[model samples]
Target: MSKALEPAGPSDGVNRWGLVDLFAGCGGASAGFLATGAFDHLWAADNDRWAAATYEKNLGHEVATVDLLEVAESSADVWAAGIRARHRGPICLVGGPPCQGFSSHVKVRGDSRGRNTLYGAFVTLAIALEPEVVVIENVPDLFATRNWELFADARSRLSDAGYRVRARILNFAEFGVPQERFRAVVIASRADHPEVRFPAPTHAQGAFSSVQEWIGELSPVASGEVAEDDAMHQASRHSKATLEIIRQVPADGGNRPIGVGPECLDRTRTSHGGYTDVYGRLAWQTTAPTITARCRTPSCGRFIHPEQHRGLTAREAALLQTFPSNWHFVGPFDDRFKQIGNAVPPLAARRIAEAVLSGGSHSEAGVVEIGDEPIGSSFSVLIPGIRRRGGRLAEGN
Candidate 1:
């Protein structure tokens, strides 16, 4: 539990809409909502202590470090009751549950099932709180053949609760994020209110904001250099061998050199098929790759700086994720990168909040088809164990 870095109160006399954020990592989505000047953050919760601390520091609000799955299973009514008592206006519930299960980057089957159903906890809170609007965000793989049933089940539950729901896969770059990150988003509105519409793209592919425009102006630092004025701008120190490999790779969008680095990454290795982005430098004029929790190192992905020989610093990564330069992330270096990588870009989130406030086109009251099997099929059998386990989806054969 960390104290807010500043006073935690909304401005006076605005009559802003209320928002309750679950899985509120570093307040990224909440930042977007609040940036619209149409919402006041009433409550936010996440299990990560450092992330909660970061949220409190940057958002000027306290975040409860509670396990949402436990709360949804045993005490949703109790929790929702407290929120309801605090605010009596129209409320929007927004969250992105642990999404590793639905991410293409995850290879292990066992690792995927545990958090796959955490969105159920989100649904539980939505049903209990009865928010006027509900939003769920996750990796685009949520609509894949393997995970579609779980997504269908969540949508079915929301629809049964009188919400007109629609799901879409949105690229954050189109919404002005300087990264080519794709996420599946579900927005639901109560039957009485206008359906929640997805916002139109604000930036086309060719005209997207570039990495140069975002972080190029920051003071340059070598691999082991630390900025005295800003801890977030400090770059990670790399090994001598790693530095040699990065130096060999051309600057500005260079791929891992063949037969040059570790033998494990060599073309002769059997496991070196699809990892083209490993040890690669980002292109200055184009959008950066999706920043992951491991983005502080070059071995993880194409996180190496465009011209520098080290991976991206936390500040650069945060800026690529559309977090404001002044947004303070509280934690050790690794923890700060994790918070930034896991956050929904505030710019994209602002568009979503604005769409909710705009009362745009009324979507139909069911799942939006983006190439998946129809709901209520034989796949329905997969959902019971998820609900019974509280949140973890059963390992299906």
Candidate 2:
């Protein structure tokens, strides 16, 4: 059964891929990977119990509720063996670690120790499992940070381990995702001919057709559009002044509709000036602003739900995340929002996964490897390091 796994086509055959989704949150990434029916997901992990439960119930993946580092260390070997015994080739891994340390939303302290270390955990597992391929994804801000050099070290470590690594920042909007989200994706191959390429954007940019295009169909919900289902989808009503400005914005007008004149402008905002994209309406024909964990708040982004006077519902956000209408999210409403906001849009993920999985120029072995050491952290391997599945793995001498 191993090595016989088939890539699920757009429809025809079942896509069967062996996978372990680390940092799996509500199965968004897995949803993307599975949307094309490309792979059979085997396992997923997140320390958050609710997230694990949600993933388990929704995607049918075996969910593990534990820290990534601890779980990988304890059962890496068995995990590898189970994968080998069950599927073909080494397993493929996908996920992005928490971006809190690198996000502008949070304060970065002490050289990003907490944040940098998280990336280290991903690197540690890659080295131990020696998986045939690894797919790492994160926000655009993740690349903006010099404080965390895990990307550099990870590239180098993969290179040394007989792999070929490709890291680049990609804008999701260009890749056919309805929103204008940007991300950083790194694809490493343990194959002889490693091909790394970003997915081409299927959407064309037009003045009338920017980020608000997809959100126009939703029933108009306001900043307070919370349903009994998910509280996070409740839009935070704007202040009187903000609402006044919002009222002026035409149905088709965005932030541009209401200029930041003296009354609309805050003296303190001369520097940053105005909410970045929050409390802004979506153009009837354009894509929405990049969906965020705070996507439910009209005050947070241009999330004013299309026609609804309030922000989007959790379901609407998931729609923007490219989740199919019939697919399910298993968790509290707010939690589902976090999962959707945190996901790699299924359409985006599927396209990228297709490229990485089939981008090989040759049928021969491929190895994804790093080329240099990162600005911070150790790339050298020591004996008896952590494992992937469960239980301790002996290190190489």
Candidate 3:
């Protein structure tokens, strides 16, 4: 957005730009951006110590463990001066704020959720740094009726700060992530530069990378078995009843057999309203369901291995999320799953980085408003403007 200086070309033998990642969960976004070899990692911050350690381990950059709220509360000018001194080149600010408040899976939905406003901290930093481009990622439900006002507020604030703001609901599967994950991405570019455009889909319906392609090569491990070579390939120990239920589930994308799970899952029961994907197996040839923090458990969504009688290993889940096999996660088993599930797929992030590098052209297909369904409904209710095609949402022009 700052026209005075452009990113240096590869011929110049100089780093093009500086990247500052906020709320960097294990450096997924940073990993992708760095893969393009266009930006230098200037700084990264996250509150979780384990996540910080993991980021430092993989990215070779120290992550500030302080909460961003404190950073936002400090003297903006002082922080801006310090950051500018470190990297004089153009800067890009990228991050995904904590999205639990806007996640459709959460039981509670409202403006009162404190985490809902954390995006403001990101906005505060962006204004202070006056970065050329700012990218904010979150759950698509950020556009839901309940949170639309907050979404609008963020756009307005960035616009008032002299940025041209655009937003879109992007399916990660379209970007070749081996899972079906949708996220709302907001990109704001300073008025001087061309509007930052959303990246086009690199993979389409039947051509999407399959779950088997990502994880099938990992040595098969039964429930409670740990691969000797890959410690992260360890599987969770299932109870006898849970193992029996998993055994009853047929291979390759089978739903839990009738009466195989809890009574709440029984369709004949009057109170039966549970999710059907619970305890289901993923199809080997199709993209996986959205990987969540609970992906290590068989009862959480369609997490069970296609043919194995166990849920996904942490390593397998990371693969489905498009993490490299060599990327090591540091934490307890559950914590490792949380880090992997919360990451923005590096492949999707790489496409976004490439778009930024190309100085994208404006597109009318950027923003898609959601329907006015109950926020807590189990199913996503998209309006006619956005249609489901081949498991991916097509943007209305």
Candidate 4:
């Protein structure tokens, strides 16, 4: 591997800027930044042990497996001092605070109340390190709440700390990932620095490759079949009855029968006919639905293979997320799935990182609104921040 591609320890000095990923689930954003050939991996932190281990194994850097709030209140300085000792160059703080509480999938809507506050801790860390730039990625619902309060507050806080912040929602497929994943992105820089702009899409909407293009090369395997040579390629074992039900569902974009068998949702399927994507098969010719933390399970939203009668293996899902084939994840099946699903597609991340490094923007003035045209017919929303250079949202033809 080239020096830029090789995993680096905290001390390796082969790159220009430095990056520390908070909520760094298995180093997705970090890997993307490294791939840009612009930033060196400096430090990382995550609360999950398995995620930290997976990140360390793939990136060759130790992840401080500490809770962000505790670190913020007690030992943030120590973490910042550690990074300073390793690299004195300007650093960029990048992360996606957990968004399950804000996600529409979660019932009751307000269960994990403390989760939203995690962004404040991220801001606290950014303030401690005084990084030159900060990037945050999250679910798009984060920006839609009453007046975009979460976004407004974070931008307000960063601006108070002397950074001009910009937020946008970006679709991963627009940047080369084969999955039609949409995410909210926020970028901030020192007020005196040149204005930061969101990266323009390299792939036009509906012009990108399909799921088969990303994971087609993987050898097909049956449910419960483990590729002895590749640990992540193992699929979940299904019961005999469940296997039969899955076989009955038509292949390639087929959803389970609405009112028949165990495939139909218990109450919601009959009551509201909602969640048609559950137990649906992925179409080989199209980009995949967003991979969620439960992607390893067949019942989780359109994760079934188009041809095979099984849910996606961890390896397949990772490839769809644009993770390198050689990138190894360390964890149990479910944990590995979560790490893969939560990752920022490296292709998308590399583009954004390059934009930040080059200070290249379509325009230097106004807020740049992205994710206006959702890829693969997925929903997209405009975030309220920054004025577009033209004072209008960039629309798609």
| lDDT to native, each model | 0.78, 0.59, 0.78, 0.74
The alpha-carbon root-mean-square deviation between model 1 and the true structure, to one decimal in Å, is 8.9
Candidate 4 lands at a TM-score of 0.83
Each prediction's total of clashing residue pairs, residues at least 3 apart in sequence or on different chains, is 0, 61, 0, 4
lDDT assessment of candidate 1: 0.78
lDDT (Cα, tens digit) per residue for candidate 3, span 349-375: 887887776775533223353333323
Q: Which residue pairs in candidate 3 have backbone atoms (N, alpha carbon, C) closer than 3 angstroms, thus clashing?
A: none
TM-score of 2: 0.74
Off by over 4 Å in 3: 1-11, 99-116, 268-274, 362-379, 383-397
Tell me, by lDDT, which candidate is best: 1
Query: Which parts of model 1 have CA positions greater than 4 angstroms off?
Result: 1-15, 99-117, 268-273, 361-397
How good is model 3 by TM-score?
A: 0.87
Tens-place lDDT digits, model 2, residues 1-397: 1011123555433335567778887777787676555566676778777777767776767777766655444665765566567666446788787544334312533444432355666766776766677889885444444524546656777888888777654556555676756566778888664555555445544432243444444444465555455443445555676566556554543552434433344433455564545566665566666788887655566766444455567767776777665446666656767777887787777777666556645321111112242212321121013113111112220
What is the alpha-carbon lDDT for the whole of candidate 4? 0.74
Q: For each candidate, what TM-score against the reference?
A: 0.84, 0.74, 0.87, 0.83
